[model samples]
Target: MRATMAARGHGRRLAAALWLVVVAASAASARFVVEKNGVKVLSPRSLRGHHEASIDAKLATGCDPFGAASPFKSRSGRPVVLLVDRGGCYFALKTWNAQEAGAAAVLVADIVDEPLLTMDTPEEQTPDMAFLANITAPSALISKRFGDALRLAAADSSSSSSSSSEEVVIRLDWRESMPNPDSRVEYEFWTNSNDECGARCDEQQSFVSSFRGHAQLLEKSGFAAFTPHYITWFCPEEYLQTRQCEAQCINKGRYCAPDPEQEIGAGYDGKDVVLENLRQLCVHRVASARNVSWVWWDFVVDYRVRCSMKEEKYSRQCARDVVSSLGLPVEMVEECMGDPEADADNDVLRTEQIVQVGQGSRGDVTILPTLVINNVQYRGKLESTAVLKAICAGFKESTEPPVCLTQDLETDECLNNNGGCWRDDKTNITACKDTYRGRICECPVVDGVQYQGDGYMDCKAVGPGRCAVDNGGCWKGTRDGKTFSACAGSESLSGCSCPAGFKGDGLHCEDIDECGEKLACSCPSCSCKNTWGGYDCSCGSGLLYIKVEDTCVGKSTSAMGWLATALVLSCLVGSGIVGFAFYKYRLRRYMDSEVMAIMSQYMPLDSQTTENRPLREEAVQA
Candidate 1:
């Protein structure tokens, strides 16, 4: 049976992270403010403080005197927006206030007269309280109701010098230092404009929607900007030489001596700065705006440090400063989770306020009306809200990949996906992961983690396993659980067979040319030698024939019976003829001797003893 197994990880460093997520969040939004260039708000009248505002709440029709913990407590089953009496509350302060009000979150809004428009900075500055929402989007609706109630109370307390819980009225017209926060609502824009001014103005408007900061908002919405922070390495000029770079690795770089070259309109100009455009690219691309994450150095931090300076001493310092700057905030990291973590601070305005305008009971009365509309935080950088909005929109921010992927072990379309790993098409297993990929979703965590070349990146096993995308065509990886050997059809990473004569480099397949290698040889003269898949030798039939097919040719007489018979016939005929001729000669000699003996009349049988006296005449036959 196929089962769906989900693996979850909380704390992962993003590539040049632009944002983070908060836990236990109620909900969130992709709120943005795109209307203001630099709006400055003005109200004809002044409004009372929070103390007076709550008193006025009592007068509202729905006001519950001594409300049960929170007015919206019973509304938990539904999405509830915390409605604050005013905007300009920071996350820490607003978070606390929202809890106090029994609100999931708070939306602080201006009285329509004072809405800010632009920002040049982000973190913090002088105290011109910006209302960064610590609540949720429902707070916006609540703000409307809260504002309406305040107006009603204003009428009741307007004429009287007495301090009734009634609200004070501020009849006002408005001008924004930037753009109007309300314009975002009117325009139906999903995000702020791309420029700094637009981002700041939109941030101000967006802040009024919630004071939870980026983290909580993302958590609540179950949405995140998939933007990755881009961090680039600008090496020193000397690293260009491949050999030198291989040796020291500190000198390679595209940047000029003083400053690295930048892809943007402005080149590095002899100064090393974090690449802003690169960061934006990452935030917009890799990490995205939907599932926000942080940025880590991956495996390049050490290498990057070395590349930063010509001298080790200077490079070390530069690397240290850069990394420190790049590191995520402790509290932010803790939000996800980590070791030796401490409780997060709940202070309001932990960061300095970036903008300033007026001063009053709210601490910036002249700017109060705009504060309510622009949603400045009570504490923190004035444009932090805007920065957040920019982060979410993925226009001003982006995400960069820790590494690039190569095509090999997977099918052609596997890489088309943003994720480098492949999925099992048959099982519909997206997490199945490629065997040789750098990043795997299901790779072991902690105790079982396996990586390539140490622990820099996680690795996994995938199939129908083929070849590795690395130098070796062989995919039978064994190191780090990689094996470069396998059955015939099931070759390793390269998915390559030895090709009848080829070999492998452990990561991939290569050709093994026997002929080119001088492995082939002549017969008999050549002794045989074996190689990867073929054998070459000197075994030929020309030297001395060993009749393997016809075993009984010259060695067997029966097989040559015809010739042997002819030889016997010739010997018999010659012997018979010679005997006949000898017989004839003897007969003729006997006849001649008889004639001679007859004439001489002295031939006898006993002549043999007296050959000299008988004169052989008796043998002549008279």
Candidate 2:
């Protein structure tokens, strides 16, 4: 019996897959250009993954529309945009088939001349639709008239093989699809917290987790405003008393959601999803009131991880724990949510319903996991980078921030291991700088001192003010109320050296013994003792050591005084002796001269007789 039931379930799933093959159309306003006969023709079209502004590729016709007919082969070995008639398969299956045949993109032309409609993915997931997730190539839907023109151009080019210029080319342009009317972009994310809804749920959760950083950055910097919305339906009045309504709705069936398990007695009912959605809405509303609306991302991500449906932990208690952990006001969120059991309208949930309707250029958001930027729907893979690029494109030219202009989003490498850069644990200073491209390691200037070195490994403080920061990364110590630093009065620009009385590289210094090494106080009467950063010396009791001369002197140094006084007396005595000798010799000479003059008065003195003195003798003779 169990085997039979399982086989029945498989058969139902297969039937659902077949039923989904019928093409469904959505409203889109993007346009594409076709080049034929040396002229460009513009036509209205709707493109899926409307992210890029323009994509140019050669046209290839008569490819399998359902991908089961024949493989698509391109002649030029370049990117080919495969054209097919819209009928045999789902839009997603067509795109997937073209992708498998090595087509860069696909354009499905409508059989009738109706307005262009968006080619969307299947609403429900099935085993046959498993290739939906791998449909990365962009696709579009064109009118019947444009399709015929492209076919004729291709036919003409193929028949006349001599001229390659006759080949048809088309350009998918989405530049004007999303308008950039202002400097700031306002976007809305239509999502649900139901984790059991399969691919759509997973996509929503993944986008929230990966895009949280960028969203918060844009919000905090005032570059963008983001709003999250959840879709809810009101049960019909006829089914109000049914078991489905009771299990799937709250507030007397006013707001409801499809049962997650799609069964009455299965795991989680629709009411559970609705309540969680209300709680998330309340979280955002409360956070926005507090002027920190970005915390909504934190609460959602945390709740998804801690309280998942698969783990059977998706309960009120788990959500409360997540809310409290993020410091959000639980009482405020509760008050905003109001009584789920009350038979009245919830102001928060009611507002969400009113905002769900189409307004201005945007249409009603009927699709799950939809992104609307600048009041226009963004149809593409719900990935972070792709969504970011579309949001950036919504900004006016030259009004984009550095985050948008950069090649990639900011990785915040400094948050992890300081980006493998140099850091001072004591000062909490790091050389890593987070930028839009990634992280860079460069020495930083702190206080007035600039650091110099290879920032990845080392950053040594330099300049006169370097000592103020970690003692210039040098060795320092203090003892007995005395402190010494190897960086004190340093003259070199970088590197460390031991101070005067210390030994070792400046990184690690030890006191030196002046007396032991005979470097100081070398006199016999001197003694030395090692200190923390230097040495101390003392002389014997009766001696004093001269630091300048590095010599010992007697304390009772009267000997130096006596030697000075003796030298002064000896100079005086020698002067007196020389004076006396000179005076006596002069007196003797005077006496001899007086005797000679007395003798000469009586007669000419023999010693005075000379040729010049002969006149005196002659006068005497006359």
Candidate 3:
């Protein structure tokens, strides 16, 4: 009997040792540093929100169950991490209270000595618990022993008079929360298609809409690989034939979701959601096969907007319209989705269920819209910027993509109301410029022309090329197919002025009436008539108006006038004839001289001596 009892005692010891090994292996490895003594304590992150992996703040003890303690306040405007006991209320409520009191983070110390468990949002969401989705602070659960040490430190510091002992400061290091094994980051988004489920659903849709562009960018650049997932529950065998199962389960109770409106025989049933979920899953599969999986983001975003449950447009046809609009293979997706009436598992949805289970370091996906980066769950608000930051953190230190290093993710803010900046409706030119840091209200340079102004109210085109853009933002008019603008020639650098035929400020010009203003046709013989931009003038018969002198002259007539004109014409003709006769005589004399000179050169004439006797004698001597 003694030998058997000793063997049993040894068996118990061995079993306990094995249990410790299992617990240690499964526990999260994140830790925080106690600045006072340089001691490190294990504090695994537990909440889901935006975690500031690089956080250093002062620690304050506010053990009050209601979070009404004054110690929670930070006197120096430094970040305060509140330490609260674990049992006063729900874990989420504690964090909420701490958050309301302006605590940067909350640490819920376990009241009893036990293994640290993850603090999760409540299973059932209540109207008052709306704060769950808005919590941006990172939280963690620490061991009881460490909690005791922190509480003791807080007491000592508060009681002591030394400035150094006034408060305890620690740095919460979450750098290891996400594993960055390589340059490429692989992430998964667990979401649902039901948009009528309230805040969580709204958040999921918002995230998908806002982050679609960024996700597609990363995927196209090969910086990240993203997969989308949906969660479905299986109906129990006993309740398979019940009305609840009929309203929710699809494929004969194999997959299911809760009714969107939570009412029987009203609005959209839960099976509708399951079917849509299956369709979305197949969209990704079909797109992946075609090597254009990024289209999945487009389909999901478009479907959410075009086919929403609240709008009662969440049907198969609506989904097909979205699929077709994105140029996806509708038949292939239909084939992948299979039949929802079949009393068997869907190939695509079955795989989704298998992947939903925890593998490696990732835990089961229990929360709606959970983001898994590098096989580790991301904790933060479901915002595009926050989620993008978490994904960026998963890259190996220096291997982050350019998008990750940017200060802000591109939101395409210029799409809405032109980002509240000045715009020229006619030219479609805007002053809003979209950048990595959201939208900037600075004038834009378009087509080599720079705009100048405050950008928010008005932007005027400037420089030599300005006239080509919206006519330099100046007044312009068109009449009778003739268009006139206040802008000067392209060489004119800036400023607008009324043209020659119009008058007003540069922004608005009215055509000037030359006839009405008496600016033209002032001569008595001229007729005054106004045209669009100028005036027309006419003169009486036998009279001519000189435009340069702005006057009219009468035509001469009668016998005396005729005789004088004829005499002048006769004299001009006589002079012309005399000039021609003189020209011919001169030409004849010159030709005769040329002929005589040529004959003398060839043979001596009677009147011409061989040159001179002296010349002849010189030639003979030579």
Candidate 4:
């Protein structure tokens, strides 16, 4: 089922849906106040907060709809308006032009129904243009509705009979903040607006078309925004293929980091090739294997960590060396490296699997270094001890493995804060626990009595006689010359005791019958007898014990017969009443239909008959 789900891309689809569900919850909105006639009007703005730009002067439109410099500039220092149309000009260019023309800030009005967008520039730009693209002056995008209302308000004020220089003002105040990453992931306007291609289009006309399609798909899938994050690279023609592949990834709106330059020579190491081949192998093995525990432990947990910690560069040669060092597989590397199609397929498959695993983990892949045991992912800290605990908890066996049961197995938790050692039997507490501050052992309590306080957070009862409060059998000592019980010390706050009806050693007690010495049964009409640690009541000669009511009542077979008869009579009467009501309803409907037919035959169906008739009423009662 998981394989089928992965193949169908169910994991990515689910992750997208989940991200969208929490988009609003994870993101904050831009603070902008727009008022008309002292009443605030609702408007959507960019999530990126900028400096406040208040405009009380007449609203001035930029010379170009895209905010590019025109023959006429906006009134100096006045807020300039721009239209969200055309794709050729970047948002930065439009805003820069307005800024250069002395506009305090630029407001790009939406031409479509989409909410205002948080604009970003193209990935690659000239050095000088990049500086200008920062949008230093407060800038924002406003909805088409808000722009229209502002225009109408301006027009209304412009035509007012009373001449007042003061114009209708629209103030936009931006608080310092940024949109949430999840909210940015949910932006799907690109998919709807870019109609040239779909998410799964087979072919495209050009690179731009392909790039837009891929970006739209990524945004719709809640992966990233619809803008590429490019990394400039300097490479030779030999590695042009690599550049092309990386460009494809970048154009899809994914962050692309340039790989280290490859030096092609007669003595080329083929390190990159080997690393790629090994990655493909790992993905294939993980995908095909029925059990992933060994694969993760051997390759991911052990080999990956060792290689990373040793600063061993990940290459094809490094992978082969690691495999040889592990003393298992060198033949499989060649097999994996031989199939290029398999490499690509496995790459895509690995992505799907990772997303599936991530969603199964916690709906967030950012919490990395994850551990999955028995199909359940651990959401705790990325520590070996934490992982071990999760894996142990997944076991369903009656007996734990020897390693799991032994405290001799070293762990960082045990080394920290004198956590102390475990007993050979795993049930007994050691003397090291006497002065230990942390948890040492998980001692079991007697039946009917549970250990008080947290079991593992802090083993306050680990010291000598501390278990006395819960009556645990841990320690004992003598008071003066007399031998006292384990928890008889006045300083010992922890001890155990039997419940009301039980008695024995604190750690091992049994229930006792109190009714044997006391007249506990109060049922007057029943015979009482002691049973186990409790009592049972039985009805006397002519009575029946009703367990539901917990009482004895007079037995009456005749009364039962009467009740059965009454139930039958009631059911019969109810059925008869329903049948009569239904029959009456049907008869009334049939009679009404007949009456309507008779009336139609005697009288005209319309008032026109009265107007057409000459002194009607049966020709004056002839």
Candidate 5:
């Protein structure tokens, strides 16, 4: 027993010597410092102006060290901010959630939130570091307003009140170093005179560009989510004139005068301004990095310093200017962002390289699949849903909002057709997407009157001498007296079209029976035959069956039948008129008389259309 005691004594002495070495090493690595109120905190060099938030506490250890209790305030309607030792997994839900709940700071008390001391790092053999996520801290502010009411009453009278009440200041760091998809390394913040990301709430309350610099780091790092300081001034908004009293505003490590309006408890806060400033910083930073293709490019672009949008002087300039300065390419510019289609042929585009991403062709239905081009989405292995959403939202910049057939924007819900949403226009149940424009969400105009130097022809000009579409919009000349078909190529039919080879004006375009010319046969033994649109070239003049190019034959031996057919074709504009007009009538059967009346009422200025027989200006769309 005495030998065992000696062995234990030796081990204790050796462990004490090792403890001294660790303490000395830590003293060398870490220095003690104090930060009073209103110190300017700067973000890391790589991440500009990233500041760590702070929170006050009751006793450094709120919960019993050996027992258990919660840090959550049951009376608080605001979301819970778990004040454990180290800020970690339990409450770090996401930045979005934090911002939504209006959490100004985080406080991690002592290990009472746990029964034992939880170190910042985990032991190697431990399979799961479940304790790492909960917040842990040595000590914290004891008298701050938040902590004053939270102090738990303890019956242990031997514990000195001063000891429990004493405040402990700690450097601002993510109390717990946790790895998350949105951010890998937690930011540790400190303040110095030259910290560059914040701005004074002076005249314009202009924001310094550096704050955004840090946010861009988070974005580029591919963090799924994040939240920065939604800072609030701890001091009162009204200034204290006494020189002895500390200044309430924290500006660059010094307290300065803030506007009476900007004093704490001011109804109109700069929270939105803070949000916008971050967004602007993102824009400037991302733009600096060559070309930006991402769309989660979050920023504040809404109007400011304006009471109404209708006033000409009221500028949506804040939003418009920030967005415009990023210098987006024409194809990258959002369509509806106040700028309308300046050029008819102009198109919005997004490209990783040479592939044509979105080509809004005329009659191409709608761009409603307001996302990656329909086929492209399914084609490429998009990294995540984020990539898909970004491509789609970016592609949707300036796309038309859907207007239901009911003509109501609010009530119109997109209807699902076979695959895409159906357009509201009753006549054309074609697929419509957010990207569609014009009356029917028809594809952008790509052709037609555009070819004409003048803007476009009106409906009145849809007749004979007018610039009307002819022959299915393929050829455009008035017909005289010739039948046209696929047999007759899409060429103008005029002049006494002669039979093809002979080329005189008898039956315009008929193949002349040149085989009847005995000498033209070139060989008395050869035979040649003729057909419309072309004829067979051969040796014998009898009947050649070869499908040749130019074998024009003279009048056939069966001439009596041909003469009668020519008489009808000569009956002005050819006997083909009735058939062609009927086919066209199939397309224009009848107009909705009721709709015409409604349109007429709306267009009372259209003097040409009177009440009796409303002369509708039949505009022919090409």
Candidate 6:
């Protein structure tokens, strides 16, 4: 029994020696120094906020070391500052519950030999604890060495002093070591996340370029998210403002909380200026001139200021200066600088026109920035890459552009392989993925036809054409008595359509046979073969489709048949008419000669006739 007791006493002495050694080492590496009355103690850095709190309460070791207790009585009415060890629960939770139990502050001691660290509970890990916004009271972490020294001091005082008043009066003050600034430091939350990727990720590229300088500031600050301070101010509106904005603003005496009225402006509040510029340039100006992109590019690349938010006069001056500096066309500059609000009525009309046009084209089916291909709005992101993909899919004339085959963008459900294929207007052929069902090549089924493939492939073996029956054709309602299966990854069918061999609406389907009906073969007599939706006419040689009258009126092949037929008909008719006229004349002459002989016999030719005959014979002889 004596040997056991001796071993226990030796073990206690060794433990006490080890604690003293830890205290000596902590004093050397300690970064925070806490003071009470005149006694100074080393502490560690923990929690971020106002670095100091002053409370005059007798230190209390809560019933539970981690402060997980309902009520712990304090020796005085002064604010109670509890001494708690790190563990058992979240530091935030402990501080919060201790505060609820009427403690003014909770000082947590590290269990390890490491220096103090600010409490960090990521929401991803403890999803319920997003932020310690609820913790109003101050909480800090001190070194285990410091905690041990305090506990030892209290014990020593309790043993030596009177039994009724063995309490050590103390003060806890967190004095920050940062040098004082001339004025208050200000902060702002600004970002360029909404800047659009025009035609490409121009905005993103621009942001990447500008963010390079800020990388060091971010590293030094040791923040997970951007915290704007007074250091970063010159960044463009399209770029995020970090500490630089606040710093510059303060330097310029412009650092003030954003005025609500100023933020809520006249016509441009909450508007996407970059997107609006893209729309005006690509959709409007491009329609008029092919080289408009250069102007738009110059504006985005050179005009760094976001003048749209400025007052009218300043905006106009800035715009004019930019245009003059760029040496762009005067008319173009004038047109762009005209007051947007001055033409409010015109703006409304234009808006109405745009909406009306979109509605008419899409049958009131889609919203703004609609991606329509052959009258079908593509169901994809309104980004440059997605728009390019949709456009590439609509082309059935030739293979897709090289970019379409190789270009890849990060999609919501897709891991960008950066070497994938665009399948069709409706789907993209992406890298294979392991899904819940199984590993499968990523492709989409369109119009009831499953286009399963690993890489680049056609939407259909024989793609639809502009003239195809299903391309922009009116609804046939169903096919083969079954409902049309066009609902899958396709637009609705509602357009003009005609049956085979016809060239008009279904109601007025006029037969447009190229050979027989309209003599389109241009031959007098041609053999016509009617085919699906068309016909082929074989005329005798020398005959072809005539463009003049659009009729087949040629003669015989390899010969002039029409001319010969016309000659023969004209000769026969002429000869018959001549023969009938000659015969009538000859009969009339014979009847006249007989009538004269009968009259002469009935009435003697008078003597005057005999004399006239002799005279006539003499005159005739002369």
Question: Of the candidates shown, which would achieve the greatest lDDT relative to the real structure?
Answer: 2
Candidate 6: where are CA atoms >4 Å away? 1-70, 125-131, 155-166, 175-178, 181-622
Query: Would you list the rank order by TM-score, best first?
Result: 2, 3, 4, 6, 1, 5
Tens digit of per-residue lDDT, candidate 5, span 1-622 = 0000000011110000000000000011112111111111121122222222222211122222211232222121233332323333322222112222232223333322222121112222133423322322222221222221222211111133444332211132221111121213222111111111122121011121222333344446543222221222223335333321132322221222222244454332232232233333334334444434222233321222221222322223444554555464322223322122122211111111112122322011111111122121111111222222222222222232222122322222234332233332322323332321112122222224112111222111112322222321222222345433321222332212332354433322334466665424444344556544334555334443223432433335336547877776587555478778987776565555556676866665345436434334443331
**Model 1 lDDT-worst window of ten:** 12-21
Candidate 3 per-residue C-alpha lDDT over 487-562 given as tens digits, one digit per residue, 9 for 90 to 100: 9857588899988878899889988887788887788888778777766777789876666776767665435667
Local lDDT at 474 for model 3: 86
Off by over 4 Å in 2: 1-78, 408-622
Number of the candidate with higher TM-score, 1 or 4: 4
Off by over 4 Å in 4: 1-88, 102-104, 112-120, 123-133, 138-140, 155-349, 352-622
Query: What is residue 432's positional error in candidate 2, in angstroms?
Result: 30
Q: Model 3 off-target regions past 4 Å?
A: 1-78, 100-102, 123-134, 164-167, 408-622
Candidates 3 and 6: which is better by TM-score?
3
Per-residue lDDT of 149 in model 1: 42
Instruction: Evaluate model 4: give its lDDT.
Output: 0.36
- Candidate lDDT (C-alpha), each: 0.30, 0.70, 0.69, 0.36, 0.27, 0.37
State TM-scores per candidate. 0.21, 0.56, 0.55, 0.24, 0.19, 0.24
Model 1 misplaced regions, further than 4 Å? 1-80, 87-92, 114-146, 149-622
Question: What are the per-residue Cα lDDT tens digits for candidate 6 across 1-622?
Answer: 0000000011121001001100101111222222211123322112111222111111211222223354443343345555566676666666666666666655565667763443533223344543343455554556676555544544444345454443433343221111112121111111221223122233333533444333223223331121211111122444234443332222122221222123434333222232233223322243225333234334433444444333322243554465556555546644542333341322322332343333322333222223233343333333344344434443332222333344262122234442244334322333343221112344444454343344444222122332132432232333345332221123222334455555655323444667556545454555667653466766556565544554455445315666788899999999999999999999999999999888987775776477678887889999
Error of 2 at 261 (Å): 1.2
Query: Which one is best on TM-score?
Result: 2
> lDDT per residue, candidate 2, 145-189, as tens digits?
755555554444455656443333345433335567678999999
Per-residue lDDT of candidate 4, residues 7-118 (tens digit): 0011110000000000101112333212111113321122112222222111222222322343222222334333222233665665555555444444544555653333
What number of backbone clashes does candidate 3 have, counting pairs of residues 3 or more apart or in separate chains?
3
Off by over 4 Å in 5: 1-248, 252-437, 440-528, 532-622
Question: In terms of TM-score, how similar is model 1 to the real structure?
Answer: 0.21
